[model samples]
Target: MLTTRVVVRGLAGLLAAMAVLVPSAPPASADQVRGSQSRVLRTLGVDAAWRVTRGAGVVVAVLDSGVDPRHHDLAGSVVTGPDLTRGANPRGVRPGRLHGTYMASLIAGHGHGPGRADGVIGVAPAARILSVRVILEDDEPGFRHFNSEARFENVVARGIRYAVDKGADVINMSISKDRPTRQERAAIRYAISKGVVLVAAAGNDGAGKADGPYSYPASLPGVISVAAADRALHKASFSNRNSLVLVAAPGVDVFGAGPGDQYWVGRGTSQATALVSGVAALIKAKYPRMTPALVAQALTSSARRRTARGYDPGMGFGVVNAARALAEAARLAGYRHTASGAGVQDPDLPIAAGGADGRPQLAPVQVVARDTGLVTMYGAVALGAAGCSAGCLVVLIVLVRRARRRREHVMIENPQADRRRRAPT
Candidate 1:
C-alpha cells in the first residue's frame, strides 16, 4: 500500500508537469499528429488573435535561399528579392528551394494552398514577405561552386542594404556557420542602424559544434538569438546550447510549406527563428511607435520564467510567450502613453530639472499640435500698444488746452487789477 501510494503521487506530479509544459494546440487539420498543433500556435486564446491583426502592414525581410514565387501559399506575398548563390546565371536564380521556402512558410506562407491536407499556418499571416536568397544552389556541374573570385561579402551586403532601403521593419536570417566573417558583422550592424529588428537562429548543432562560439548574427550584440524546443518545451536535440541564446520556440516536427507545391514538416533552429521573427512583426504592427529596443525589451521581459532564471546555455530567457509578450506590450504601450502625456505639462511652466535616468521627460514633437492652444500675444500686444499711445497723446493735448483756457479766464477776470498794478510799477 505504501509503495502504491508513492507511485500514484509520482504519476500525478508527472501529469501536472506535462500540463504546464504542453502548449495549446493550433486549429484542427488532417495532417496534425498528437503534438502538431501544440507546436504551431504555442500561444492560444488572446495571443493568437493578437497575432492575426498585429502583423498587418509590417514588412519582414527573410534572408535565406530563394523562395518559390509560384507556390500557392506564397503567391502574391513575396516582394522583390534576389538570389545570392554563387552558381547559376548572371541573374541569381532560385537555389535549392528547401531553406528559403521553409522559412517563408513559417513567416507568411498561406499554408501551401488547397488539397494538401496539412494545415500549416504561419505565425504572422498578414506580414509582407521580402525574400533575399543567400545560399548556394546545385547545378548539372555539381552545384554552382563559389570561386575565390565570387564576392560573398558584396552579395550579402547588398541584400542587407536593399532590405533596409525597402523599409523592412523586421529582418530574419536563418543561416549560420561556424565562422562569421567581419563583413557579415558589418552587414548586421548596418541593418540595425536602419532600425530593422533582426532575429537569427542559434544554430541546429546542439552542444556548440556546428555553431562555433555561438552562431553568427545570434552571437552579435544586438541580434535576437532564438533556439528550438520540442512540444515538452525542452531544448531540442539538435539546437546548440549557448549562453548567447535569447529565446526558444517550437522547432521539432514543425509543419510548413515545402517546394513543388507540397506540405512538409521539419526541425531546425531556422524554424524557431522564423517564429520569433513573426512575433516581432506582430509587435511592430501593433505598436507602431515602439523602437526595436523596446520591442526586444517587451519580449525578454515577458518571457516565461523557468526554474533557471535569467539566460542559460539551453534557454536564454525561456520559451517565447506570445500571450505574455503581447500583454506586456500592451502594458508598455499604456505606460508610454501615460508618460508621454505627463511629460508635456503646461509649457508656461519650466520643465522639471532632474538627472538623466530620473529626469522629467519632455513630450514628443507630436504633442505640440495635439495638446497646445495657440495664444496670439504678438498681435494683441501690437494693437494694445497702439491704442495706449493714442490715448496718452490725446490726454496730453486736452490737458494743455484746459490750462490755456484757465489762464485766459484769469486774465479776463483780473484785467482791471492787472492794469492798475502795471501803471504803478
Candidate 2:
C-alpha cells in the first residue's frame, strides 16, 4: 500500500528570523541599517537591465500571502486583486503578515529614499504588481490546521486563472507544494496557452542534502523554477536542487518591505522566485509579443552557467543574469519562431552531450527543406524506389548496407572516434 502526503512549499527559516528582528529594532529603522538596495540588484546586472526597460507596462501577478498596497515602496505599483485566503481582506495586510508585501516590493518596489541607503528599488522598479492572494496565514476555521493541501491547490488554481483573465503578462507564484493535483496542472496549462510567463520557487529543503523532492508549479512544464543563491553567488544551503531548477538568484539576506511600512531582510527560494519574475516582467515589457517559451529561452540561454560545460542539478543553467537576458530578449524579438505553449522543454541538444558527465537524451528534431537545391543519396534512394526500376532500388539498398557495415566496424574498433572527429581541425 502507498500513502500520499501533501506539503506546503513555504520556507520558514527566513520568515522566523524576520519576526525576531522586527520587534527589537528601532521604531524608525525596522531592522539593521543595511544598504537600501539589495546586493542582488547589482549581482543580476539590474542597473544595465533598467537602462533597457523598467518593466513599464507589464503586470506581474503575485499569488501568495496578501500584499499590503499601502507599503511605501509598493504604493503606486500594486494593484490589489482577489484575496483567495479566507478572512484576509484585499485592502490591507494582516498584522505581522508580510510575505506578499515583500514579494511585491522585490518585483516593483520604488524606494522612498534617494540612494542605496534609504529605500528599496526592485529589479523592475516600474513594473506593476497584481496582488492575487492565494496563501492563507491566518488561523481560520478551514485553515487552522497545518495541512491544507486540498484547499491550497483549489485557491492557487483559481488564482492562476484569475491572473490570466485579468491580463497578467507574468504570474509570480512564490508558493510551492510537493505534489500537484490534476486541476492545478490544467490551470497551469491554461495560463501557458494564454502566453503568461509563470515563475515559481524551487523549494528550500535541501540544506544538508544533495538531492531533494521536486516542488510543483516549479517542476511543472513551462514554469521557470528558480533556486536561491547567496550574495557571493553560491547556491544557498537551503535551496533545493534538481533538474527542474531552471535558474538561480539572490535569496540570502534579501531586503524588502514588510507590513506597517517596515522593511526586513530574509533568505529563501521564494525571494529568488520573485526576483526572476521581476526580470521576466522586464523582458515582457520590452517585447510585448514574446511568447512564454521564448522568454524562458532568453533566460536560460543567457544565464551564467555553473560550469563551462553544461547544466547541473545544483544551479540548472546557472544564476540569472538580468542584463544578458534582457539583451537576448531584445535579439529574440527580431526573430520569427513558433510560439509553443507554456512548459515546453527546450529542444536543443545537451551542451556537453556524450561527455563523461553528460548523457545524451532523445529530443525531437525538426528538419526543413530550403530553396537552395541540396540532395542526398537518401533522397535519390526514395525517388528511385518510388518511380524508377527495382534494379536501381536494389543497388541503392546494397550500397546503404555496405556503408552501415563499414560504419559499425569503425565504431566497434574505436568507440571514441566521435571525440576525435569533433576535435578542432
Candidate 3:
C-alpha cells in the first residue's frame, strides 16, 4: 500500500519507557563495528545511525520464503514463523530458504564475534525479525506452480494478517507480483489501518524497458516501494523504473548472510527493500508511537540525491539515508497526528511546529515553485501587451493612409507644384 493512512491510536506511555535507548557505545566498540561493516552498510552510514538508536524495541516482519535462524549473524534475532506454502516442495526442487535468509540478515543481522564484528551488521542491528514464509525461490520446487496458479495465490494476504496478529510493527515484503487480488488489497488495508508500516520491492525489470510493469503490493496505496540504486547512485539497469518507487538503496553486488550459516552475494530490489525496512524499525524503536504516515514522511522528506521536483520515477524521492531519516522522524514527532492524516506528510507545506528533540536537519526543502499561478499571471500580462501594441500599430497605419490620400488630392489639384516638390528634395 502506498498512500493510505489512518489515525494512530494510544500515544500513551511508550516513549522513553518503551525503548531502552542504548547510549552511544565506547569508541572501541563503534570502531570495531565500523571496521567490520561491509561497503554496503557503510555507504548508507548505518554506523552513524547507531549513535541514536540500534532499533532496540521494534519487530520487523520479513514476509519472504523463510529465514535460517541458526545463521551466525542472525542467531537470537530471528523468530521462526509459519510455513504458509500450504503445499509441499516439488519433487526434485528443495527449499534452500536462501533468498529469505539473505533479506533477513540485511534487516536484523547481529554480527558474530567479540564486538559482534566479524560479519554483516544490519541497518537496525538490534531489531528483532519475524520470519513469515510467503514466497519461494525461483528455483524452488513449487515456485512456478505457487506463482502461476490460484491454489496458493492468497498466501501473501494470509501472511500479512499473520504478521499483524503476531505484533509486528513493520511488515517487509521483498517479493513482487504482476497482479493484485482482492484479499491482498484487503490485507494491506487492514495492516495500514492497524499502524503497520509496509514496505515491498518495486521489482527487477529495468534493462530494456523505460518503465516496467507496475509491481503489485509495491504499487499498492500504502506500501513503501523500494528501487535498487547502483554504486553511482543511478537506478540499476535491472531495477524497475516506475512512479511507485518511494526510495532506492544499494542493491548491486550486495553480500549478506545466507542459509547454512554462510554468506552470499546477491542483487535486486529485495535487498533494497529489506534495508529500508530495517531503517523503518530504527524509527519505530525510537519513536514508539510515530504513525505509519510519519514514518514514510521521515524517509521521503529526508531522502538523499533528490531531484528539484522532490520525486522521480527512476528513484522516487531519492536514496535512503538512515541517519537523515531518523533526524526527520524527530522533527515530525511533534506534529499532532490528526484523524485524517493531514498536513505533516506533505514536504512542501510548512509544519506548524517541529519536535524539540534537537536533531539537526540534514536536508531541507529549499525551493518553492508557484508555477501554476505565476505562469497564468505572466501569460495574461504578455497577451494583453501584445494586443495593445497591435491596436496602436493598426491605428497608426490608418492615419498614415489618410495623410497619403490628402497629399495625393493636393498633388492632383496642383500637378506643377507636386512635380516641383518631388524633383530634387
The lDDT leader among the candidates is 3
Task: Give me the runs in candidate 2 sitting further than 4 Å from their true place.
Answer: 1-38, 87-96, 113-117, 138-146, 149-152, 336-425
Kindly give the stretch of ten consecutive residues in candidate 1 with the minimal lDDT sum.
1-10
Better of 1 and 3 by TM-score: 3
Candidate 1 lDDT tens digits, 343-416: 33432222444345564454545535532233566667888999999999999999999999997998899998
Stronger candidate by TM-score (1 vs 2):
2
Give a tens-digit lDDT track for model 2, residues 258-321: 7677776777888899999999999999998888989999998898747666687777788888
lDDT of 3 by residue, 159-276 (tens): 9999999999999988877777766887887787678999988887676898876787889888999998888888888788888789998887666766776665556788889999
Tell me the deviation in Å of residue 147 in model 1: 7.4
**Against the correct fold, how does model 1 do in TM-score?**
0.65
- Model 3, residue 305: C-alpha shift (Å): 1.0
Cα distance off (Å), candidate 1, residue 104 = 0.8
Of the candidates shown, which would achieve the greatest TM-score relative to the real structure?
2
**In candidate 1, which residue pairs get closer than 3 Å at backbone N, Cα or C atoms, i.e. clash?**
138-143
Question: Using TM-score as the measure, what is the rank order of every candidate, best first?
Answer: 2, 3, 1
Model 3 pairs whose backbones collide: 1-221, 1-222, 1-223, 2-220, 2-221, 2-222, 2-223, 3-221
